[model samples]
Target: MKLKRTMAILMAGVTCAGALAGCGGSGSKDTGSAASNSGGLTELTFVMASRDEFMSSIEEAMVAEAEPLGYKIVSQDAQNDSSKQIQYIETAVNGGAEAVICLPVDADGTQSLIDAVGEKNLVFVNRPPTNYSELAADNVTYVGSNEDTSGYYQGEYLANYFKQKGQKEVKYLMIQGTLGQVSTTKRSEGVIKALKDNGINPVEASAPVVADYDRPTAQEMIQPLLTSGKEFDCIIANNDAMALGAIEACKDAGVEINFPIVGIDCTADGAKAVQDGDMAMTVFQNPVGQGKGAVIAADNMINGKKLGTGMEELGALDTSGKDYSDSIFWIPFEPVTKDNVADYM
Candidate 1:
């Protein structure tokens, strides 16, 4: 009982404890990575990617998974700004955080932030980094799903759905997430590539996408496309939010697109939409699994725990791809069709 509790507390983010008390001596780049703050619970910091519903799921899961182990998790919302995210790291370092978990707003721009951790402890979620070396660095781990897998699943589903129905071509309106975000880029790439791989040449009905993974924004963005009189076989959104928005747009325009509209992040609403036949399907990007996996990895690393064989079964992503390593943990993604959507809801 005591052992389990200690493990939990160690990954706790920020609290009223002795975080500012002692251990003021900074070591490697990850200065406080393995140290305890004076007279307080271990301090950990979580830098949120944004405050959207999807991001909220990550935070809620982190708290649910980490708090019971006896840690107070402090969250810093970057509000889609990379500069502000760096500021959050400075705050964590000065506040004496033992470890920092971040869902980066800018994956390519996180090198400075990674440097800022100074070896204290760094775990990155959501965005998959282009720099593979960072994940293998000492005191650094990348905890996220395979960047292209979710998109691949979405594209694969569409291709198979149409192929099974004996359809030849697919005309899709791509409602993307944040334009430059790794999630957006990879998800879009995965879908496009997967479609091509499956012998499906997808046609884009809408050009100059309306980005930013917001429902209203997506709804608004699709309005122009609806009025353009272009035929669309389906909609592909980087997230469920945009997909839901597209649905709303169609309803308001009285445009019925009776096709398989696919999305990622089988969010609660997305799953419900599938049940009601509002959308065809979505992929389950496990926020709960990613959140808890981060805490567990941090706990084990701090205690000098080596990852054992068959660790790949944990199911976010397997360790066989480019990002595969002991330091990098991949969370697997699952496709949620109507036949299995109820299991998610």
Candidate 2:
């Protein structure tokens, strides 16, 4: 496959410089061959949607895992542009990459990416496409925790807290991530479903604010709500960053945080907040596990190994009892509270 890709590029008179020039403003860091490195080292291109605290951790883990296995990783930042992501994948494929690991900018718009990589192994990380059925090829797979599970954990924690308090109904302020992403929608829906399943009536204290998974944006958006004299029993953020932002907003407004505040992605800050008695709980979405799993999946595919091969290190794979288990690798999410925050830290 590598030889054929190389010959195709050469015969088409396509140089690395020309391909990269077409990538236009997309930030990239190449640690392997520029465009012509077809040496003994296998090349894998990692195209990220954007860089954030959790995403950076995943990227670092991928780099660490790849180095010891003699795989060269070319990391690129798509800056949340679908077109840029497609360009990066094309450039990587034309540059003789054995596999393309991408965190799609727009999960719903991944058909273009699948078409771009053609026969090369493509591993979609962190965010899976909206349509799971679209990933029909054996060469394509998804590696990430179930977003619904993460939110379910959050809702379960909150439900237990309220139930122990003997409260039947709770009003919550929700800080959502990017509006259209599968993570945002599923996380939001899952939390609601869990709350209902737990026999808790949930009410929206205020209209949910979209923060785009940004901390400062979450803080700014929630500040007015804090001072608006509205009654909310708790705050629920799609991710830890936004949860921390809500905490900041509460502090800035001199509001006492007597209610539970929960979030997903037991990030360092979120765990610290849980320990400090600020955040009631958080769900741990293992970035390191996801990253390593993605790299291993790519290596397995390239070597003609079955999917999920060598992924036992990530614990038992959650096949969801589906026939397509081979194409989806699920990393479990753990609920982190004061009792178990130390374990995650």
Strongest candidate by TM-score: 2
Once fitted onto the true fold, the runs of candidate 1 whose alpha carbons sit more than 4 angstroms away are 1-40, 307-324
> Candidate 2 at residue 273, lDDT?
99
Q: How close is each model in CA RMSD to the real structure?
A: 8.0, 10.7
Per-candidate TM-score against the hidden true structure: 0.85, 0.88
Mind giving the per-residue lDDT tens digits that candidate 2 earns over 264-283? Answer: 88888998999999999998
So what's the TM-score on candidate 1?
0.85
lDDT by residue for model 1 (1-345), tens: 112111211111112122221112111132424334553556567898688777787777777766665566788999878889988988887776767888887778778778887756777876756676555455676666777688999989998988987876788889988777778888999998888899898888767475588899999988888888898888899999999998999899998768777889988899999999999989988777677777665555455454212233443233243423545556667888999886786
**lDDT agreement with native, every candidate:** 0.72, 0.79
User: In model 2, how many backbone clashes occur?
Assistant: 0
Clashing pairs in 2: none
Lowest summed lDDT across 10 adjacent residues in model 1 is found at 4-13
Off by over 4 Å in 2: 1-40
Q: What is the alpha-carbon lDDT for the whole of candidate 2?
A: 0.79
| Clashes per model (N, Cα, C within 3 A) | 19, 0
